[model samples]
Target chain A: MSKVVKIFHGPQHPGITGNMSVELDLIGETIVKARTHVGYLHRAFEKLVERRTAMQAFTIVCRICVPEPDPNEENFARAIEEITGLEVPERAKWIRVLVLELSRLAAYHLWMGGQAGSTGLYTVPQWSVGYRDYILDLFEELTGGRVYHMYIIPGGVRRDLPDGFLDRVSDVMDLIESKLPEFDRLFFDNAVFKKRAIGTAVIDPETAIERGVVGPPLRACGIASDVRRDDPYEIYDKLDFDVITEKGGDVYARALVRRREMEQSIKIIRQIIKYIPDGPYRTKIPYPMNWKLKAGETYVKTESARGEFGYYMVTDGSEYIRRMNVRGPAYVHGVSLLEDMLEGAQLADVAMIMNSLGTCPPEIER
Target chain B: MCTDNPGVWEYIANWARKHSIWVLAYGTGCGAIEMPPTMTSRYDAERFGLRGAATPRQADLLIISGYLATKTLKRVIRTYEQMYDPKYVLALGSCTINGGMYWDSYNTIKKLDLYIPVDVYVAGCMPRPEAIIEGIIALQKRIEEGRAEGAKKYRENIEWYKKNQREVFGDEMLPDYTWNFEGGI
Candidate 1:
């Protein structure tokens, strides 16, 4: 008879993407059953948002997911815009696209580090995290905050681009692009990484779709669906870029999708730099001190680095928000999908699978 | 509690402890993101002898990086207690002090000091890597000066801390020392 032992994987584990735990009933090195638990990072954001004004609520929403916070801000801002029928300026749209793409690049870099780290590759995180810091530097210059921008608001961005900000951004882009070949040589095309990731955590395309997997994880399964292309938001419709996909739904496929998406994001950023119009960055809204909204409900979704980040907001003609619900991809990917994938998986591959899925616990619990 | 004062060996110990602090790599919140950069080449926290320890047993520092939900509070205390003696607690972000942005949230604790004795608090919605480095320097100074007695204080005032911890985690009581020796295989 095979003896089974139950062990808790996280809540403070290094391999865990955030504050989450996976209970694994294991026999030897093979996992028999897995259950994901997440309440550690819960700040009751949905309930907290109800107590604040729209502007104040914007500040808090970004804290939902730390790695790629702009998506939450983007969703919240767009939801309010949709509800109020507010039309953002053309330049603002371009800037929003730029912010979104830069955010995607940053998240991908962080993910690269996590993926590599999970596989016992330390050089990748050391290099990738350093590179990510440059993007954070740009974010600091633009929004006055490194991690949480809170720059994207209902009407438009909070402020205009600083002098030569585009030039600085281009410099960082140039540096990152130059290092891609080195990264490919070291991580993507490396024999060790390929051996570890290629066939691991293989997801069926049909299962991916039925399971509502979006973004690179879904695209990695050969479905050429992207929120930017399928449901165009901001100036994504006007931009020119392809929705990248891979036939293999394993960790390797997802890595390739993200790597190619990085190149695509770079292309999109260059386009924004060239085509951005000269105009007001934001439209002045009426006094925020006592800002009131008409009774309404709206849902807005954006392609965050993880997957789809959607916000469902309701207002009852009051200054305070009536209800706000965040539907982060991690909610699905971290709990249900993680549990499904971890079954029968070797205990050692659990962190690798979790990292590839990009599970952010704060978003799940919030 | 039985130690002597101002000995030459104590100074040597303080200096050695100040130079080598193994920080447990347990990221409690948003402030966790900043740690990667701080430890990496750009900020290089390792240069200051601040390195990531995989478990509590080997760590000398416990950094509560952001807001702590009640659920996490239980685990943090457990992890804190698990660390070896002569430990320090460094609280980061405004969330640790007066609850910062999550002050009104139902689950997040208001003041971190009430639950755990914090040695240093770095103020920011989420403090930058530079500020974090500065906080580390301050902590190092405190260690050298032998003023960082948070763990000692925790041990001395066990009843007060236990009372506060009980208030936060009502019925879900935690074991005093988690590692049980009596439970045999």
Candidate 2:
């Protein structure tokens, strides 16, 4: 007779992303049940926002998702714009798109690094992390900070683009595009990676939608439901680009979707570089401390690398936000979906499954 | 006749000591982004015998990169306790020292050394790769001179460390929802 064995894969396990624990019931290496444990990195971000003014919350929003923080800023700004009926300058819209696409590129690069590392492919982390730094260099040149770029604010961005900014961005894009083939050689096309990744952690299209998987993970299931396309915001409606999708919905499929999406992000960046209008990048708002927003609420959503990152903001005609709730994709995918998907998989596939789903704990905790 | 087996075992032991220095990548905040590049080929921290180990039991160095919130401080303490003796702590970034930009913020801890003993402090919002390499070398020098033993002494004074941590964090250690805001550092 076989007996059930309980195993705790931690807030520190390599199989788990960020600081989160998952309790698994296993018979040998095959898992029978999975339960997610949060509160490990819970920082009370929502309550903290409630205490700060709307403008002050701008700085805190970026901490919601460290790898892809721009969407939080974008959502916060857009919600405020919607509440006050503030008109953002056309040029500012283009700049917002540029920041978002760059963020997407950076996030995809990070995901590629983590995904490769999960499978014992060490060289990919080396190649992708080095390539990711070029993007960080561009961010430093554009926004003064590398990781927490508090650049995207309400009304518009914090400052205007510096001289030859577009030219420098284009140069970085060219370098990133040039290195894609080498990444292909190292991880994407390598036979060992293919053997381990393909058909592991399979997610059917029906299961994906039911479980609320979003971003590349959803796209990998062959559903082309990008908020940038379907619920068009910024200049995404005006831009022309294909929504890359795959049918497999496995770890390999998620990797393929992100890989194809990187090229699309490059294409989007090229479009922004070619067509950015000549005008001011920001529209000044009233003094942030004394700013009184109209009494209303708005739900703003953006296509972050993880998925449909949305923020619902409510104001009571006061400086302090009445309620600000974040709907990070990780809450649903990492907690609910991951718990269901891990059951019956081999122990070795746990990390691959978590990576494919893009389980960021900070986002979930927030 | 007296020089036949002249300390060959000692030579091999010294060589092994010089070649392997496993690091526990105890990332506490945003500065973790810089860690990948250092560990990767751009700087190749591995050439200096710095490889990221999953468990603290096998590691020789603990790199506390970026900020440590009151929430993260508890885990860092637990991880430090779990690590074997003769371990060194390298606090990376300004946030880990005096809290940097987050100094005025409520959630982040002002000083990491107040909770656990830190050997070398690498100063920068996020220190550049060159600075990190320099920090590793500085730590190696300290190790050669037996500076890491100080950390072991601090650990031996376990009650003192716990009292200081409680004094800093207060009722935040409890799992109550109200304690989240009231007892924040």
Q: What is candidate 1's CA lDDT for residue B111?
A: 95
**TM-score against native, each model:** 0.97, 0.89
For model 2, the docking class works out as acceptable
How high a TM-score does candidate 1 get? Answer: 0.97
Q: Which stretches of candidate 1 lie over 4 Å from their true place?
A: B1-4, B179-185
- On DockQ, the candidate that comes out on top is 1
The residue pairs that clash in candidate 1, if any, are none
lDDT of each: 0.89, 0.82
Scored by TM against the true chain B, the candidates give 0.93, 0.81
Clashes of each: 0, 0
What lDDT is reached at residue A249 by model 1? 96
TM-score of chain B of 1: 0.93
Q: What global local distance difference test value does model 2 have?
A: 0.82
Q: For candidate 2, give the lDDT of residue B41.
A: 67
